[model samples]
Target: MPLALVDCDSFYASCERLFRPDLRKKPIVVLSNNDGCVIARSKEAKAMGIKMGVPWFQIKKAYLANGGHVFSSNFALYGDMSARVMNILECMFLQAYEVYSIDEAFLDLDTLDKNFNLYKFGCHVKRCY
Candidate 1:
Protein backbone atom coordinates (compact mmCIF):
# COMPACT_ATOMS: atom_id res chain seq x y z
CA MET A 1 0.00 0.00 0.00
CA PRO A 2 1.11 3.54 -0.65
CA LEU A 3 1.01 6.42 1.76
CA ALA A 4 -0.78 9.65 0.86
CA LEU A 5 -0.34 13.25 1.84
CA VAL A 6 -3.06 15.87 2.11
CA ASP A 7 -2.26 19.56 2.24
CA CYS A 8 -4.49 22.59 2.04
CA ASP A 9 -3.35 25.61 0.10
CA SER A 10 -3.62 29.09 1.53
CA PHE A 11 -4.69 27.49 4.75
CA TYR A 12 -4.89 30.60 6.89
CA ALA A 13 -6.84 32.48 4.29
CA SER A 14 -9.12 29.56 3.70
CA CYS A 15 -9.95 29.30 7.40
CA GLU A 16 -10.67 32.99 7.55
CA ARG A 17 -13.02 32.75 4.58
CA LEU A 18 -14.92 29.88 6.14
CA PHE A 19 -16.78 32.37 8.30
CA ARG A 20 -17.06 34.95 5.55
CA PRO A 21 -18.50 33.23 2.51
CA ASP A 22 -18.84 36.62 0.89
CA LEU A 23 -15.08 36.63 0.46
CA ARG A 24 -15.02 33.33 -1.35
CA LYS A 25 -14.69 34.85 -4.79
CA LYS A 26 -12.92 37.96 -3.56
CA PRO A 27 -9.20 38.43 -3.12
CA ILE A 28 -8.25 37.84 0.50
CA VAL A 29 -4.90 38.06 2.29
CA VAL A 30 -3.93 37.08 5.79
CA LEU A 31 -1.11 39.03 7.32
CA SER A 32 1.64 37.91 9.66
CA ASN A 33 1.87 38.94 13.30
CA ASN A 34 1.63 42.70 13.92
CA ASP A 35 0.20 43.02 10.39
CA GLY A 36 3.73 43.01 9.10
CA CYS A 37 3.68 40.83 5.98
CA VAL A 38 1.59 38.72 3.66
CA ILE A 39 1.77 35.26 5.11
CA ALA A 40 -1.16 33.57 3.34
CA ARG A 41 -3.09 34.59 0.26
CA SER A 42 -6.17 33.23 -1.40
CA LYS A 43 -6.06 32.23 -5.05
CA GLU A 44 -7.69 35.48 -6.01
CA ALA A 45 -5.09 37.44 -4.06
CA LYS A 46 -2.32 35.55 -5.80
CA ALA A 47 -3.96 36.40 -9.10
CA MET A 48 -3.72 40.02 -8.00
CA GLY A 49 0.10 39.61 -7.70
CA ILE A 50 0.34 39.69 -3.95
CA LYS A 51 3.37 37.54 -3.27
CA MET A 52 3.75 35.69 -0.04
CA GLY A 53 5.96 37.25 2.67
CA VAL A 54 5.87 40.72 1.13
CA PRO A 55 5.51 43.42 3.74
CA TRP A 56 1.93 44.60 3.94
CA PHE A 57 2.93 48.24 3.72
CA GLN A 58 4.73 47.61 0.45
CA ILE A 59 1.56 46.31 -1.17
CA LYS A 60 -0.97 48.37 0.73
CA LYS A 61 -1.50 50.76 -2.14
CA ALA A 62 -1.90 48.11 -4.83
CA TYR A 63 -3.98 45.79 -2.67
CA LEU A 64 -6.38 48.40 -1.41
CA ALA A 65 -6.48 50.07 -4.76
CA ASN A 66 -7.85 46.83 -6.16
CA GLY A 67 -10.39 46.36 -3.31
CA GLY A 68 -8.65 43.40 -1.78
CA HIS A 69 -9.52 42.21 1.69
CA VAL A 70 -6.88 41.91 4.42
CA PHE A 71 -7.07 39.99 7.65
CA SER A 72 -4.87 39.65 10.70
CA SER A 73 -3.34 36.30 11.52
CA ASN A 74 -5.77 34.20 13.58
CA PHE A 75 -4.01 31.10 14.76
CA ALA A 76 -6.79 30.08 17.13
CA LEU A 77 -9.41 29.96 14.40
CA TYR A 78 -7.05 28.22 12.01
CA GLY A 79 -6.05 25.65 14.64
CA ASP A 80 -9.65 24.84 15.43
CA MET A 81 -10.53 24.40 11.76
CA SER A 82 -7.44 22.25 11.19
CA ALA A 83 -8.41 20.00 14.08
CA ARG A 84 -11.87 19.53 12.60
CA VAL A 85 -10.42 18.58 9.23
CA MET A 86 -7.91 16.17 10.76
CA ASN A 87 -10.56 14.49 12.85
CA ILE A 88 -12.75 14.05 9.80
CA LEU A 89 -9.89 12.52 7.82
CA GLU A 90 -8.96 10.13 10.61
CA CYS A 91 -12.51 9.03 11.42
CA MET A 92 -13.72 8.70 7.87
CA PHE A 93 -10.73 7.63 5.80
CA LEU A 94 -7.39 6.80 7.40
CA GLN A 95 -6.82 4.03 9.89
CA ALA A 96 -3.65 5.81 10.95
CA TYR A 97 -2.16 9.17 10.10
CA GLU A 98 0.34 11.79 11.15
CA VAL A 99 -0.25 15.51 11.13
CA TYR A 100 2.60 17.10 9.21
CA SER A 101 1.52 20.64 9.99
CA ILE A 102 -1.54 22.65 10.86
CA ASP A 103 -2.65 22.18 7.25
CA GLU A 104 -0.96 18.98 6.13
CA ALA A 105 -1.16 15.30 7.04
CA PHE A 106 0.31 11.97 6.02
CA LEU A 107 -2.26 9.21 5.79
CA ASP A 108 -1.53 5.50 6.01
CA LEU A 109 -3.36 3.83 3.17
CA ASP A 110 -2.33 0.26 3.92
CA THR A 111 -5.70 -0.50 5.44
CA LEU A 112 -7.50 0.34 2.24
CA ASP A 113 -8.27 -2.49 -0.11
CA LYS A 114 -5.84 -3.07 -2.97
CA ASN A 115 -8.56 -2.28 -5.51
CA PHE A 116 -9.22 1.18 -4.10
CA ASN A 117 -9.35 3.87 -6.77
CA LEU A 118 -7.12 6.76 -5.76
CA TYR A 119 -8.88 9.27 -8.00
CA LYS A 120 -12.23 8.40 -6.52
CA PHE A 121 -10.78 8.65 -3.03
CA GLY A 122 -9.37 12.05 -3.80
CA CYS A 123 -12.73 13.30 -5.09
CA HIS A 124 -14.38 11.93 -1.97
CA VAL A 125 -11.88 13.77 0.19
CA LYS A 126 -12.50 17.01 -1.61
CA ARG A 127 -16.22 16.65 -1.18
CA CYS A 128 -15.71 16.15 2.54
CA TYR A 129 -14.34 19.65 2.78
Candidate 2:
Protein backbone atom coordinates (compact mmCIF):
# COMPACT_ATOMS: atom_id res chain seq x y z
CA MET A 1 0.00 0.00 0.00
CA PRO A 2 1.29 3.41 -0.92
CA LEU A 3 0.96 5.64 2.11
CA ALA A 4 1.95 9.10 3.12
CA LEU A 5 2.37 10.21 6.71
CA VAL A 6 2.34 13.92 7.30
CA ASP A 7 3.62 15.05 10.67
CA CYS A 8 3.70 18.69 11.62
CA ASP A 9 6.77 19.95 13.41
CA SER A 10 5.84 21.80 16.60
CA PHE A 11 2.16 21.49 15.77
CA TYR A 12 0.89 23.35 18.81
CA ALA A 13 3.38 26.11 18.28
CA SER A 14 2.43 26.34 14.64
CA CYS A 15 -1.23 26.56 15.61
CA GLU A 16 -0.40 29.37 18.00
CA ARG A 17 1.60 31.11 15.32
CA LEU A 18 -1.35 30.97 12.96
CA PHE A 19 -3.41 33.15 15.29
CA ARG A 20 -0.73 35.24 16.98
CA PRO A 21 1.86 36.83 14.75
CA ASP A 22 4.02 37.71 17.73
CA LEU A 23 4.53 34.03 18.59
CA ARG A 24 5.89 33.14 15.18
CA LYS A 25 9.56 33.26 16.17
CA LYS A 26 9.40 32.90 19.92
CA PRO A 27 9.69 30.01 22.32
CA ILE A 28 6.16 28.71 22.95
CA VAL A 29 4.62 25.94 24.96
CA VAL A 30 1.13 24.44 25.01
CA LEU A 31 0.14 23.29 28.42
CA SER A 32 -2.27 20.58 29.53
CA ASN A 33 -5.36 21.17 31.64
CA ASN A 34 -5.07 23.55 34.59
CA ASP A 35 -1.73 24.62 33.06
CA GLY A 36 -0.25 21.67 34.82
CA CYS A 37 2.32 20.49 32.31
CA VAL A 38 3.89 21.07 28.98
CA ILE A 39 2.14 19.04 26.31
CA ALA A 40 3.74 20.70 23.32
CA ARG A 41 6.85 22.77 22.73
CA SER A 42 8.35 24.69 19.88
CA LYS A 43 11.83 23.84 18.68
CA GLU A 44 13.19 26.61 20.87
CA ALA A 45 11.32 25.34 23.91
CA LYS A 46 12.57 21.79 23.31
CA ALA A 47 16.18 22.97 23.25
CA MET A 48 15.83 24.47 26.73
CA GLY A 49 15.39 21.19 28.66
CA ILE A 50 11.67 21.71 29.10
CA LYS A 51 10.35 18.22 28.76
CA MET A 52 6.85 17.07 28.00
CA GLY A 53 4.76 16.59 31.14
CA VAL A 54 7.27 18.51 33.22
CA PRO A 55 5.21 19.95 36.02
CA TRP A 56 4.34 23.58 35.42
CA PHE A 57 5.50 24.54 38.91
CA GLN A 58 8.93 23.00 38.42
CA ILE A 59 9.40 24.65 35.05
CA LYS A 60 7.81 28.00 35.90
CA LYS A 61 11.05 29.59 37.03
CA ALA A 62 13.13 28.27 34.19
CA TYR A 63 10.39 29.00 31.69
CA LEU A 64 10.21 32.62 32.80
CA ALA A 65 14.00 32.84 33.02
CA ASN A 66 14.22 31.60 29.45
CA GLY A 67 11.36 33.74 28.21
CA GLY A 68 9.06 30.91 27.24
CA HIS A 69 5.40 31.69 26.72
CA VAL A 70 3.00 29.21 28.18
CA PHE A 71 -0.50 28.79 26.86
CA SER A 72 -3.38 26.65 27.83
CA SER A 73 -4.42 24.15 25.20
CA ASN A 74 -6.80 25.78 22.77
CA PHE A 75 -8.59 22.76 21.45
CA ALA A 76 -11.28 24.86 19.82
CA LEU A 77 -8.82 26.68 17.66
CA TYR A 78 -6.75 23.62 17.00
CA GLY A 79 -9.81 21.60 16.06
CA ASP A 80 -10.96 24.23 13.61
CA MET A 81 -7.53 24.36 12.07
CA SER A 82 -7.45 20.59 11.82
CA ALA A 83 -10.74 20.58 9.96
CA ARG A 84 -9.46 23.07 7.44
CA VAL A 85 -6.35 20.98 6.91
CA MET A 86 -8.39 17.86 6.28
CA ASN A 87 -10.65 19.69 3.91
CA ILE A 88 -7.66 20.85 1.93
CA LEU A 89 -6.34 17.34 1.71
CA GLU A 90 -9.70 15.96 0.65
CA CYS A 91 -9.79 18.42 -2.18
CA MET A 92 -6.23 17.73 -3.30
CA PHE A 93 -6.17 13.93 -3.43
CA LEU A 94 -8.48 11.42 -5.06
CA GLN A 95 -7.53 8.47 -2.91
CA ALA A 96 -8.69 7.86 0.61
CA TYR A 97 -7.02 9.76 3.42
CA GLU A 98 -7.38 9.46 7.14
CA VAL A 99 -6.53 12.08 9.71
CA TYR A 100 -4.67 10.33 12.47
CA SER A 101 -4.52 13.34 14.73
CA ILE A 102 -4.25 17.09 14.66
CA ASP A 103 -0.71 16.83 13.38
CA GLU A 104 -0.70 13.55 11.52
CA ALA A 105 -2.48 12.01 8.53
CA PHE A 106 -2.28 8.99 6.27
CA LEU A 107 -2.97 9.03 2.54
CA ASP A 108 -3.39 6.11 0.20
CA LEU A 109 -1.61 6.54 -3.13
CA ASP A 110 -2.08 3.09 -4.56
CA THR A 111 -3.88 4.36 -7.64
CA LEU A 112 -1.08 6.61 -8.79
CA ASP A 113 0.54 4.87 -11.76
CA LYS A 114 4.07 6.13 -11.23
CA ASN A 115 6.13 5.14 -8.24
CA PHE A 116 5.03 7.70 -5.70
CA ASN A 117 7.50 10.43 -4.78
CA LEU A 118 7.31 10.19 -1.04
CA TYR A 119 9.54 13.13 -0.26
CA LYS A 120 7.93 15.38 -2.82
CA PHE A 121 4.51 14.27 -1.69
CA GLY A 122 5.47 15.01 1.89
CA CYS A 123 6.55 18.45 0.82
CA HIS A 124 3.16 19.00 -0.78
CA VAL A 125 1.44 17.84 2.36
CA LYS A 126 3.58 20.15 4.46
CA ARG A 127 2.76 23.06 2.23
CA CYS A 128 -0.94 22.23 2.27
CA TYR A 129 -0.80 22.20 6.03
Candidate 3:
Protein backbone atom coordinates (compact mmCIF):
# COMPACT_ATOMS: atom_id res chain seq x y z
CA MET A 1 0.00 0.00 0.00
CA PRO A 2 1.09 3.58 -0.57
CA LEU A 3 2.07 5.89 2.24
CA ALA A 4 -0.21 8.83 2.88
CA LEU A 5 0.96 12.19 4.09
CA VAL A 6 -1.32 14.42 6.11
CA ASP A 7 -0.37 17.99 6.80
CA CYS A 8 -2.01 21.16 7.98
CA ASP A 9 -1.77 24.31 5.89
CA SER A 10 -0.76 27.58 7.44
CA PHE A 11 -0.43 25.75 10.73
CA TYR A 12 0.48 28.57 13.07
CA ALA A 13 -2.05 30.94 11.54
CA SER A 14 -4.72 28.24 11.55
CA CYS A 15 -4.02 27.50 15.21
CA GLU A 16 -4.45 31.16 16.05
CA ARG A 17 -7.77 31.31 14.23
CA LEU A 18 -9.12 28.15 15.88
CA PHE A 19 -10.09 30.08 19.01
CA ARG A 20 -10.97 33.24 17.12
CA PRO A 21 -13.81 32.34 14.82
CA ASP A 22 -14.15 36.01 14.06
CA LEU A 23 -10.75 36.01 12.41
CA ARG A 24 -11.58 33.23 10.01
CA LYS A 25 -11.54 34.40 6.39
CA LYS A 26 -9.62 37.48 7.43
CA PRO A 27 -5.96 38.11 6.66
CA ILE A 28 -4.02 36.64 9.57
CA VAL A 29 -0.26 36.56 10.02
CA VAL A 30 1.73 34.83 12.73
CA LEU A 31 4.96 36.59 13.47
CA SER A 32 8.29 34.96 14.14
CA ASN A 33 10.48 35.42 17.19
CA ASN A 34 10.37 38.90 18.66
CA ASP A 35 7.68 39.71 16.11
CA GLY A 36 10.48 40.18 13.62
CA CYS A 37 9.20 38.36 10.56
CA VAL A 38 6.14 36.79 9.03
CA ILE A 39 6.24 33.08 9.80
CA ALA A 40 2.87 31.59 9.03
CA ARG A 41 0.06 33.36 7.18
CA SER A 42 -3.50 32.45 6.29
CA LYS A 43 -4.79 32.19 2.74
CA GLU A 44 -6.23 35.68 2.94
CA ALA A 45 -2.93 37.03 4.16
CA LYS A 46 -1.09 35.33 1.30
CA ALA A 47 -3.53 36.87 -1.17
CA MET A 48 -2.78 40.23 0.39
CA GLY A 49 0.89 39.85 -0.71
CA ILE A 50 2.30 38.89 2.67
CA LYS A 51 5.17 36.48 2.09
CA MET A 52 6.76 34.20 4.62
CA GLY A 53 9.97 35.55 6.21
CA VAL A 54 9.13 39.11 5.21
CA PRO A 55 9.91 41.53 7.96
CA TRP A 56 6.73 42.46 9.75
CA PHE A 57 7.56 46.14 9.75
CA GLN A 58 7.68 46.22 5.97
CA ILE A 59 4.07 45.15 5.71
CA LYS A 60 2.69 46.67 8.91
CA LYS A 61 0.93 49.59 7.26
CA ALA A 62 -0.78 47.64 4.49
CA TYR A 63 -1.65 44.76 6.79
CA LEU A 64 -3.34 46.95 9.38
CA ALA A 65 -5.02 49.07 6.77
CA ASN A 66 -6.67 45.99 5.36
CA GLY A 67 -7.96 44.87 8.77
CA GLY A 68 -5.51 42.03 9.00
CA HIS A 69 -4.88 40.26 12.27
CA VAL A 70 -1.30 39.88 13.59
CA PHE A 71 -0.18 37.55 16.34
CA SER A 72 3.05 36.49 17.91
CA SER A 73 4.12 32.87 17.67
CA ASN A 74 2.47 30.82 20.42
CA PHE A 75 4.29 27.49 20.35
CA ALA A 76 2.72 26.24 23.58
CA LEU A 77 -0.82 26.55 22.29
CA TYR A 78 0.18 25.22 18.89
CA GLY A 79 1.88 22.21 20.46
CA ASP A 80 -1.25 21.27 22.40
CA MET A 81 -3.42 21.58 19.32
CA SER A 82 -0.99 19.52 17.25
CA ALA A 83 -0.97 16.79 19.88
CA ARG A 84 -4.74 16.65 19.76
CA VAL A 85 -4.67 16.28 15.98
CA MET A 86 -2.00 13.56 16.14
CA ASN A 87 -4.03 11.69 18.74
CA ILE A 88 -7.08 11.77 16.52
CA LEU A 89 -5.09 10.53 13.55
CA GLU A 90 -3.50 7.79 15.63
CA CYS A 91 -6.88 6.52 16.73
CA MET A 92 -8.35 6.70 13.26
CA PHE A 93 -5.43 4.85 11.66
CA LEU A 94 -5.11 2.35 14.49
CA GLN A 95 -1.78 3.82 15.51
CA ALA A 96 -0.23 2.87 12.16
CA TYR A 97 1.37 6.23 11.60
CA GLU A 98 4.36 8.40 12.34
CA VAL A 99 4.35 12.03 13.37
CA TYR A 100 6.49 13.72 10.73
CA SER A 101 6.29 17.12 12.34
CA ILE A 102 4.10 19.13 14.63
CA ASP A 103 1.72 19.65 11.72
CA GLU A 104 2.38 16.65 9.49
CA ALA A 105 2.18 12.88 9.61
CA PHE A 106 2.80 9.79 7.53
CA LEU A 107 0.10 7.15 7.79
CA ASP A 108 0.55 3.52 6.85
CA LEU A 109 -2.32 2.63 4.58
CA ASP A 110 -1.17 -0.99 4.36
CA THR A 111 -2.51 -1.55 7.83
CA LEU A 112 -6.04 -0.65 6.71
CA ASP A 113 -8.38 -3.35 5.48
CA LYS A 114 -8.16 -4.08 1.76
CA ASN A 115 -11.81 -3.11 1.33
CA PHE A 116 -11.30 0.35 2.69
CA ASN A 117 -11.91 3.24 0.30
CA LEU A 118 -9.16 5.84 0.66
CA TYR A 119 -11.20 8.72 -0.71
CA LYS A 120 -14.03 8.07 1.70
CA PHE A 121 -11.58 7.72 4.51
CA GLY A 122 -10.04 11.09 3.62
CA CYS A 123 -13.43 12.74 3.60
CA HIS A 124 -14.26 11.20 6.94
CA VAL A 125 -11.02 12.54 8.39
CA LYS A 126 -11.79 16.00 7.05
CA ARG A 127 -15.23 15.92 8.56
CA CYS A 128 -13.79 14.85 11.88
CA TYR A 129 -11.85 18.11 12.04
* Local distance difference test, each candidate: 0.89, 0.82, 0.91
Colliding residue pairs in candidate 3: none
TM-score of 2: 0.83
- How well is each residue in 2-114 modelled by candidate 3, as lDDT tens digits? 89998998899999998999987999999988999999999999999899899999999989998999999999999999999898888878779999999999999899888
- Report lDDT (Cα) of residue 71, candidate 1: 96
Count of steric clashes across candidates, in order: 0, 0, 0
Candidate 1, TM-score vs. the true structure?
0.89
lDDT of each residue in 23-124, candidate 1, tens digit only: 878999999999999999999999998998999999999899999999999999999999998997788566588899999998888877779888997898
TM-score of each: 0.89, 0.83, 0.92
Off by over 4 Å in 3: none
**Cα lDDT for residue 32, candidate 2:** 89
Off by over 4 Å in 1: 93-95
Error of 1 at 98 (Å): 0.8
- List, residue by residue over 24-95, the lDDT tens digit for candidate 2: 668899998899888999998988888988988998987888788888999888888788878877776654
